[model samples]
Target chain A: MERVPVLKIGDILLVSIQIDMEDQVALQLQEDLAERIVATGVHGVIIDISALDIVDSFVGRTLATIAAVSRVLDAETVVVGMRPAVAITLVELGLSLPGIRTALNVELGIALLGKRDVGDEPADDEDEDDPAAVTTS
Target chain B: MERVPVLKIGDILLVSIQIDMEDQVALQLQEDLAERIVATGVHGVIIDISALDIVDSFVGRTLATIAAVSRVLDAETVVVGMRPAVAITLVELGLSLPGIRTALNVELGIALLGKRDVGDEPADDEDEDDPAAVTTS
Candidate 1:
């Protein structure tokens, strides 16, 4: 049984799926990722699936499961580098993968994680020039 | 003085925001979009924001508003091509832009709209092979 490797980059965990995953492999990855997220106390997890050409509902649900688990452990999950075909297929399969933040690639994923760490400071700087930054509530 | 163009793509309407928008402009686009959705009887609306670098809370709310209005008008809205910086900024501002389907780019956004038109037919085909495809309801 091949296990997906979870690499810790600073305070974030990175999981790059390099092959077509079987159902069992996907489920194993989900469990492995959840345990690592709790053990490492990481603030973010970036799952890169750029290499995958097909993402059936099982794989999609596993990704969603990993994301939900990470959130409960105080980590945000960003699934990046999804191919256009795979995205179309996922949506067509009626799985929107909600509550999962996504980006075009790993670099942007890292940037998104970093921005969350900084919180509202960067947005505040821009607020000086843009008055509409006022929250509508 | 520039108004966002809403082009009719078959039964779906496409509104590609081509520039960084002010609060008022964003609000106007939301209104224009709602009116168009009702007037045109389109099944879906794709709002492309690939050009935007910053999406403050006001703009984020407007996007949500458009999605809500479209739903009431029997139209689905897919917001596409959000810059990573903008996404990070929006999340930091406490606005997830919920109730809006998002795609990586315009092409995928269009594809998503098309899939919704077909509804669950394609998803049903894969259900036979995958037992987990059972909708959790």
Candidate 2:
């Protein structure tokens, strides 16, 4: 039974799934992430799965479950860094992994979480000058 | 004050914002949409913004607000058919409109909303032989 480590950076929780993501491991990660979200009072959770060569239906469902649980706890979950083949596989498996947010990478995931917060800012609601800082190749 | 019409299609509410969104009009649409969601007991909302040439910060924020509000009311909001220029304007204005789901068109938006409900479905969690029905250009 391998345990996934949950890291806290600033106000967000970062979980990078580096292992093979067995059934038990996936369930464990889901439970651990929920508890971490509550204990740390973090508003954002980023699960980087770039290292995963394959995301089966179980792993895909686990990610979607973690996202739903995070939402219920008033926290947001972003599943970033999915490989193209894995994405195609998930689509083929009929697991769209709905209710899950994604980004091309961890940096974009963080920016997306922060971007939502900026939307609620009263002062910058009318600010027309954003640096257009997001540049992806 | 012109009102944005919210049409009920099956179990979803479709709001096509064809008019120029003045401040009052946007606010009214927000309030109207909330009421309609409650009245219709629908779980999905599709906002069509394809006709608008300009989607300023105010309109963008209003869209975000509608999304947040719909989520609170247990309804998912998907903004569809946004012109590329409007999207560029939103990014440049620093209003990422986070926490909102988007689709390229109304048909895709419906598919996205339907995709989430399939996630919670327990029976097909492991089904791998899907037809791969989703074909996007």
TM-score of each: 0.44, 0.44
Query: What does each candidate score in C-alpha RMSD?
Result: 22.7, 23.2
Best by lDDT: 2
**lDDT tens per residue, model 2, A1-137:** 55665656557777767566778988888888899888978889988876577888878888888999997787889988787998898899998889899998767788888876632444332436556534557
lDDT of 1 by residue, B2-39 (tens): 45556554566766564456667777777888888778
lDDT of 2 at B25: 85
The CAPRI classification for model 1 reads as incorrect
Question: Residue B21 lDDT in model 1?
Answer: 69
**Residues A1-137, candidate 1, lDDT per residue (tens digit)?**
65555655557776767545778878888888888888978888988876577888878878888898888887889998888999999889998998888988766887777777432343233322557778999
- TM-score of chain B, candidate 2? 0.84
DockQ of each: 0.01, 0.01
